[model samples]
Target: MYDAVEALEGRQFDVVYTGKGALCYLPDFAQWADVVHQLLKPGGSLYIVEFHPLLNAMGSVALPGDTDDLIIRNDYLEGRGAIAHDTTVTYTGDQIPGRQRSFEWMHSLGEVVTTLAATGFQITRLRESEVLQWPRFNGMHQTPKGWWRLPDEAPRIPLLYALLATKSD
Candidate 1:
């Protein structure tokens, strides 16, 4: 991450993209948000696609049995809480390996909005979707766009959201 920033530091850009990969693993959203704002050109836009915290809580580790077997099975009310799970994911040029250790911090729908607002971005749109690009868990209804959804459990609420913000022109 440092290398990527160093390459961009001092160079003007029109748009900056950030994703907390796998589980929105942003230990410090404020710091990253601040850096992204700094790199933007006047009238630039920031297109951020983040995984809903609920997806984070449900460990990514694939289960040997049904997909439901791997989830934390909680409503996912946003706040500070502890969830321990073995998440299966692929790392850059490497595999996460089965049973890798990972942690996630829950942020409510409102929390994401407020956090970005405090960072000085004007909200243009908050789009939601249940599209599962990759398999996050088992028992998900497959969609053409690769979204795995719990048709019976959660149809209205999405498992991910994309937020678009812009700097004051």
Candidate 2:
């Protein structure tokens, strides 16, 4: 963990991409922002494409019988700190022998933007999409382009979000 920042000591990058389910595992955005800032040169940019908090709060589940039901099973915003999960099964259908424990924290859009702004990064763009990379919910359909989206009859909800931030030159 400590070597992450050290790995890019004097090097600078034009762009950094972070995404999917990555943010939840990070307990400290300030430290993350600092590392990003250090690794980037002036005028560099950071692009993030991640799962929306609303989708995360809903808690993706396999609803084979009832595909239309949308439920909020978890907190939408950060309240009691990190949420802990202990399970043997992985998302990829793999079962481990030993105990598997993980911690995740939900971050609101406001918090995400403010953290980057506070770290001196300028927000360039923000986009929320109804399409997802995978069928997060049952009855999702795959488009010809390979993206998954809800049918026209289903309510439009943001399943993913992307944000671009740039450092001052």
Best by the TM-score measure? 2
Taking all chains together, each candidate's TM-score versus the true structure is 0.69, 0.87
Q: Give the distance in Å from residue 45's predicted Cα in candidate 1 to where it truly belongs.
A: 0.7
Model 1 regions more than 4 Å off:
1-7, 20-23, 58-100, 152-155
How much does each candidate deviate from the true structure in C-alpha RMSD?
A: 4.6, 2.5
After TM-score superposition, the amount by which residue 142's alpha carbon in candidate 1 deviates from its true location, in angstroms, is 2.0
Span of 10 residues, lowest total lDDT, candidate 1: 66-75
Give me the candidate number with maximum lDDT: 2
Per-residue alpha-carbon lDDT of model 2 for 1-169, expressed as tens digits?
3357687566889998997988888887778887887778899999999999898887544467655567888888876789888999876659999879989999888889998999989999999999987887767899999999988887898999999999975
